[model samples]
Target chain A: MNVALRFDPVRLPDHCQDLRQEVRDFLREQVVQGVYDPTARSHGYEDICRFAKAVSERGWIGMAWPREYGGQERSFLERYVVSEEMLVARAPTRRYFVADRQSGPTLIRYASEPIKQRVLPQIIAGEAMFCIGMSEPNSGSDLFAAQAKATKVDGGWRLNGAKIWTTGAQHADYMIGLFRTSQPTRENRRHGLTSFLVDMHADGIKVSPIEMINGVMEFNEVLFDDVFLPDENVIGEIDGAWKQATSELAYERSGPERFLETFGAMRAFLTAVEGTDDTRLQEGLGRLIAQLHTMRRMSVSVAGMLEAGREPVTEASIVKDLGTVWDQALPKELRTLISLMDYDQYDVQAYRERMDFYTRMAPKLTIQGGTTEILRGIVARGLGLR
Target chain B: MALDSDDIHVATAERIFSDRADLQTVAHDRDGAYRASLWQAVEENGLTIAMVPEEAGGVGLTLEEAFSLLRAAGRHAVSVPLAETMLANWALAAAGLEIREGVLVPLVPAPRGHLAIDAEGRVTGVCPEVPFGREAGAFVALCDGPDGPVIALLDPAACRIEEGTALSYEPLDWVHVEGAPAMASAPAGTAAALPEMAATARANQIAGALERMLDATVQYAQDRRAFERPISKFQAVQHLLARLGEECAAAVAAAGSAADTLSRGETGDALLLEVAAAKVRCGEAAEAASGIAHQVHGAIGITREHALHRLTLNALAWREDYGTEAHWALKLGQLVSAGGADALWPLLASR
Candidate 1:
């Protein structure tokens, strides 16, 4: 069997250069105004909301969507440039990044017309926030094993289970959640799940904060205690959410955010090594930069494939697999290189502090989204090994 | 410049390779006689001079097309100097020299023997590890001259050839030219940037070879059985193959981007950055992927009887050609360092 994986070289278009420049200018202004700190691990909710509003006003949020829902009808590549710039700048994108990246697109594709009319506009206006509720206490990587049940009621469904590791759920206005609706068949273990759009403000829903190892409450355990959802809130096919779930993996996996999450550490490392004539340090830095460049190229090529209306599931999984592994290892590698340097020679205190935080954040890089093990399994199947 | 999956040139080259240069057949040919016919087939297809202009008495294919063809040549691990010939012809054409009919190899004067040019344009140097230097009829080299760099086409017969072989058993000979007369010489012109060009060529070759390696390893994993099932069913073996896939993807992306950059006629810092990154990244991929491929195939991978050795050994050998990971990494590091810390993101994002 042919196991060749294609990552076609795709250069950003000329227009993307202009868009990138505009993003840089806007980010620079934000930095000067002290709207958010690029070096910080997290931004305040107000800062995130303000920055999201500013970015939405520029027609960047929901950029790749149709213009009917406040989108600009821009290309995925253009949206790619915006997302990468925001990530590199470490902008306060926490409020709307999930909605812009996946939730809005998911709703556009599967939501009812009324839901789209109500939610897409709010998402595009930066007034709405979304959190993904896929992982539960027992179904982190094996998502098909999700036990969050949704039973049919008079006019809607009643959800009565807890979803763990629900990022941004406490602050989100809505959540795109998966609920088990029926039993799985012997042939297809992935059968019987359904997707629902949950209103966070709905009664019987409680979000309990879960503090991470990094001393951040960035995720939560969302408990749905007999929460009633209108029948119209169901997304796509009932007992067939598996189909919709797999289709979005390509878009969600192959993105700039997968690799650029710890790019701030790289920037800080560069600052510490500035003016050093050491060849060893330079070589290490060069290797890191080269790896980053290759990852970016692969990611961009996947974006181009997405633009061509092709679903490159395996290719996108390969990107995430490689990107997450590299990013997870980047902080430790940088730490090793910095450990060899003379401490008094350079002002590396700030960089060291950032490295400490990044080291803590690095473990979650591969664990979040699709774990490395699961991604590798997807890649293996793509290689026809399954 | 997205990779052209349906390029005619690549398809043609693939056809030639699949027909004439099957790895198993070539591996069994201990006498190495299959190389002549394979080289003749490739040369007759006008692939060697594909990068040269038609007006210059060459095939005149675009750089992208030529690199695609080279990538195909690499996938089969054809034991000849196809990439060398292409680079040589490109250098000769850039210097406005006549294209030679037989095998041509381009020599980059660094990390090996040195070459000096006198006022009369006679070349003197001993360049080592020139790929296929012993078999090549002529050599195209960019020599350091009294004025500047000079591009010269020299007869290989005039030089002393100390025959050598790389890990892949390809001809890698050292040539000592004691005041050998130049067949044709001119200002280096575009040929002066031979290091980056060579790196780009080797990067493409490494990418192609890595792809084939991945294919072979995956096939082996599926066919090989353990515990009454295919080893591929094992999660460990599957993950290993997946990592191999990642390395192959990285190599392809780096090399493809560099090829795209070169095809656009980028030079200097832009060219240096891309080519260096490609070489460094692809070289790293080669190192990591080869080990994993060997591990997946077990004992069969290391033996000469199996065809896996052909691709894996060549992948390792190609890492040292043009420039090693360390070599290019140093150059790239210095470049990045010179640009300072604030410029790093913009420089990377500019691509």
Candidate 2:
């Protein structure tokens, strides 16, 4: 039996270029106004919020959502253009990225009408920050192994357990957490888990920052010590989060962020080696650019699929697998490519700093969203091998 | 799967290829008997001249449709010069020349020793690695005309051919033309596009072959047993096959996008970037996939008896045909570098 794999050569819609330019202009203005340093590897908490709010004011966050929720009701392709431009420009999307990308959509789909009316608008307004609580200290890639309990109370669920590696948790206003509501059946190991919209500011929630190798304190160990979540905060069917989780993967895995994490290093390399007549340098840089372009095409194709209301799970996994792997190796590859060339010809300090930051950031690229092993398993299932 | 009007041609090509050019048949035939028959069937099905306009005495099909036919040809692992002939016919028609019947392989001469039109308008110079050159009734050469670039149909009988074969046992000959007689010649404004066209064709073919390889490897993994279970049950084997699937997807996306760009009449740096990136990406995928496909198959895949060679070897052979990955990589790299650091993202996002 043939596995039906379709990439479908999807080009961006004709009007996306205008939207892309609009995003570029807005980001340029941010840079000019000293809002965020494009050259910096990371930003402070206030910087991130200010930038996210500016983007939200432009109606870019949650752009594909309906107008009633403060969204622009734009096409996914338009949103894609906005997201990629923001990523490439190194705009601080830390505050609203998760909400705009996945959490907002999840809330709109599964949150109660009152919860949606309250939270979706806040997400659209960039007044809320969201973090994923799938990974625990025990379960990193194996999301089904989450041991966080959410026992039902009189009018709510009492949450207890720690979620480690929760990115931006310290600053998150809300968390779309996976909590165990029942024991997994022998037939389905992925059962018993339920997704809930946990209020981070609620009592019994403690967020402790986890410092990374790059000396950046981004991810946090979030402990849910009897945190109360009302019935309205429960998202989707109780103990049916597996179905919802898999569907959201297509949106999360295949985005510009998958590949553009090390774009600064590439830009630095280009600046360092600009005007070089050396053949080796050109060839090395060219292959990287080619791969980048191909990855973008695949990412855009996935966006096209999403726009057309098709869940391209397999295609999205493939894109993330290739894109993340390529991005992870890029810093080292660029290092090797520019090692032999004279450093004095370019901004050696800036290039070195960018490379240094990206080199530290590379290992987490594939591990963060979905590890290489997990993504490959998903792809194999898609290929009908398992 | 509803058959759209565009897919109708591709479907017919797929059907014809499966019937006459199935992997078992093509792999088993030592002689050219089966390949000859397959070529005959392909020509009879109007797949040979699909790129030429109907006004020029050939099937008027879009570039996308023609590419799909080539992709189907690739999936069957047919050794016929179908892609070359289609490209040659398209060039001939674009140049307002007569579209000849039979296998007329297009030659993108090596940059240094490329064929040229002399004072008497005859094609001259030594063009090497001319795929299926010996089997061709004529060689479609994009020559350097006195006025501009021109497309010249050179009679293969008049040329001295040094026969060669690729790793796949497909005909890849070197044709030396010392003022060879021109069957037809005309100024082709789009003559510079032949190389990119050829690259796009190879990219599509590589994409198709990769798909075939993935299918074959996945099936093999399922059937082959080890430790009382199918090899596919093993996580290692599944991951290898999954990696192969990723490469196949990348190739398909890159090649399909390039074909679309060419079909939409995009030219200049935009077309160059798309075609070059496609060739580079597909070539890289072929290299990576060929290894994974063979690794998954073990000893049997290396043997000539297995149909795996028919797909992998040809895909690898195409990596060097139009231009090696390094060759296109250099061109693309230079283009990107020349545009400077600030322009790279804009150029990439333009597509």
Flag regions of model 1 displaced more than 4 Å. Answer: B2-6
Residue B30, candidate 1: C-alpha displacement in angstroms: 1.7
Model 2: clashing residue pairs? none
| Chain A TM-scores, candidates in order | 0.98, 0.97
Question: Tens digits of per-residue lDDT for model 1 on B174-260?
Answer: 889899989889888887877787888899888898988898888888889999999999999999999999998899889989988
Give lDDT tens digits, candidate 2, residues A131-239: 9998999998988989999999999999999999999999999999999999999999999999999999999999999888878899899988889889999999999
Interface RMSD of 1: 1.3
Model 1, A16-113: lDDT tens digits are 98999999999999889988888677888899999989888888899989988889889999999999999988899989999998999999999888
Q: What TM-score does model 1 achieve against the real structure?
A: 0.97
Query: Which parts of model 2 are misplaced by more than 4 Å?
Result: A344-349, B1-6
The C-alpha lDDT values of all candidates are 0.88, 0.88
Q: After superposition, how far is residue A105 of candidate 2 from its true place, in Å?
A: 0.5
